[model samples]
Target: MTFPRTLADLSTAELGSGYQAGDFSPGEVLDAVAERIAACEPTINALWHEDLAAARSRAEESGARWRSGQPRGALDGVPVTIKENIARKGVAMPSGHAAGDPQPADHDAPITERLEEAGAIIVGSTVMPDWGMLSSGVSSRHGITRSPLDPALTTGGSSSGAGAAAAAGYGPIHIGSDIGGSIRLPGTWLGLATLKPSFGRIPLDAPYLGRCAGPLARTVDDLRAAMTVIGRPDARDYSQLPPYSGDYRVPDFSVSGLRVAVHTEAGCGMPTDPEVAAAVDAAAQRFADAGAQVTRIAPFMSEELLVDVDRFWRVRSWVDYHGLDIEDQRRILPYVARWCTAGADVPGAELLRCYQSIQTMRQATVAATEPFDLVLSPVAPVAAFPAEWPMPFNDPDQPMGHISFTVPYNMSEQPAASVNAGYTADGRTVGLQLAGRRFDDAGVLAAAEWFERSAEIAAPERTVG
Candidate 1:
């Protein structure tokens, strides 16, 4: 029943095969994951509300199935973590905000139910900024979720703790939500693999929820496996569409013949770090070397869309708690209240105008890239920012600056992923983003894999085994 060694030692595919072949039991793997979480939680505070007993019980059930020689599902025996904002049955569902009306969830969110059905045990939930507003994982109520690589550095927030937990080897797979680079930014900062599938590829039963939850894993294979589990049509979510559920058999997708658009300025005016630019340029050349036609494209976004997208995101956060009482609001954190008020304060006319603007931008951006199979760019302007300063809030005028490189896809609802392209001289990570047209989740992953294999940007030993 013992596992090989570390949770870091296993991938989602390896864990599944091990269960199928009787190499180990889910109970053992879950136990190892729990132990790792125990060791790392003191520094990372990754787990918001964990029931070790429930995780163990689920693992035991999976172990029983293995004993009978009937594996439960593709993700059988895998240990995974869910973002706290996503409901887990009977768990407290708080936005981590002071002014928010906190409540316990009555049922599992569709994604959670799907993961459990696929035989993946949810070991715990990771921390997020109240309602996922700021880029820093810091919440006056939830404390800070620091990077495992260096405690002083920030783990990209909203999805901060999940990334830190995964990077620290607490689990092979982690589920995170992305609205404005929540999944991609943290993965980039921590040197992990993550996918923000196109809007509706994964279920979002509640349109009010601005972000869609997706997988964050150490390997592309693990991310693919997790995607198979949760990326499906869910009756609960009107936004979810059928998954591109094909075996990731590398299609006759020769890069040499493929057309890839490179966005050097990333459609936003923020400065792209030389390290990140060089890594992405190098990845593009690798694509060229592999036979893909790479062409640099001008910034494809409109200024109006950029402003409106930011407003829409802020409004979503406010709408979540706008109904609460002043007492409830007072209970939430200051920054959460600040953001919600900001969203509430937007002139009614401007709010309507912003919504309409987002639609126009989505169309224009899609039209501009429709000719290319994939678009490649940097994931963030900088590597890992200091944990002390949360992004978008660190500076007054630069509210959306840190996320400039990754937010367009969220606004457009396109499938995008952040692959570890390379690192800087100081050892900070650099991420190359590959974005594809809506519902081309597999294609985006395929492109990322090509870059990873070609660029040889393996996970660092310090972060993983």
Candidate 2:
């Protein structure tokens, strides 16, 4: 077997089957991946810091295990790329910013350790904007990552390189983190699968932050397989809940008695593009046709809740980039510095107010949507923007303009996903954002799978199975 259209083209089961049959060894797959990375690196600008030799060494070890009939773990030979923000022992884990001291990471972050333990070789670290403060993928340290579909358009950030690499066929699965639309927006722009699980479903531990991290793949099945490997609980991360109960097995997504709220303005001031609105409207009808009750609401969050989430995100920026050296600070993208400074300006009381308001909003959002099982909205206000331009949300004056749809869920700690609804006449993709209540990851994934299977949008070029 050879590389396929998507990194997910060969399902996890198929990869295992290939390994069992001796059709292709991990070394051979690694060679193909290395070639693809070299071939697309110029245009896509995906993989940032890499050690191809290290990746090959791991592949050789995996090949030895396969020959001995003692595979290391579930993703034994799978080549996976991780976002730069997540730590991997001994590898430089710069968050697309110049390092102050550049000290070696003492240990792999919990999620990275889990991936390594499962035998997925860390081929390279994908790039992100400094501290993930910006959403447009441009950073002084790593340059800008462009969309595989159109190099001129934006490849959503700060999980930017993960999406571009996956789209450019570097590997079958790439890990990414999301605080506010980092994963979903990039996935939407690149025409890939992005699963933003409930905040605490996946363990996330780091030197400075605790945002969630998960895989970005070309198919939902691939995502599920990867999640099984990396989404386990870790004592290092206190925010993680216990392993999900098997009791929530999703039945064939029957909308028969399900209540879904369709909120165009997800409790923010941003306006959905006409094309995006039309696509989401059609998707809601499809959900209705599938036998579900769909209701359109003005917005999803309370006014106060929206304000709080925005403030919280801004404050976190200060926490992420504090005490950096001047050169490191200068190496950050303009937008990252802008947000970090904005975060610095937030007073102590305002930050505390935001956290307190989060509780009220969570409760209010839950109560308001008690009658609904799921919520549907646009993933990004527009399909994809120009790569060099600042994202609407990065503009502090337009907090409600860009991240209007995404920030609330981060505050609520819900499970949300972006599915490729359809493409615009100009060829940009529109994503339908589907969200489920806290810990209802299975439900959200099931709903996303339903829509992904229903809508037959073709994956972008240069992806691998």
How accurate locally is residue 210 in candidate 2, as Cα lDDT from 0 to 100? 26
Model 2, 160-265: lDDT tens digits are: 9998887776767889998767888887788888888788778877522225787787777677777787777888777888886453338766766789888776
> 239, model 1: CA deviation in Å?
1.9
Question: Tens digits of per-residue lDDT for model 1 on 1-465?
Answer: 122356445887788778888887888787777777776788877788886798788888888887887876777768888988888878886765555545778888888888888778888888888778777778766888888777777888779888887887776889988887899988888888899988877775565434677888777778888888788788788766765567644677567788998876756646778887888898888888888889998877655566677777777667776777777767766656665566877888888898888778777778878999999888887778887665734653334766766777876788898878888888887778889988788888888877777677756544322
The reply for model 2, stretches above 4 Å from the true place, is 1-9, 99-101, 207-210, 245-253, 302-308, 319-322, 325-327, 393-397, 462-465
The TM-score leader among the candidates is 1
Q: How accurate locally, in lDDT, is each candidate? A: 0.77, 0.76
TM-score of each: 0.93, 0.91
- lDDT of the structure predicted as candidate 2: 0.76
Model 1, CA-based lDDT = 0.77
Query: Runs in model 1 with CA error above 4 Å?
Result: 1-5, 99-101, 243-245, 248-250, 319-322, 461-465
Name the 10 consecutive residues with the lowest summed lDDT in model 1: 1-10
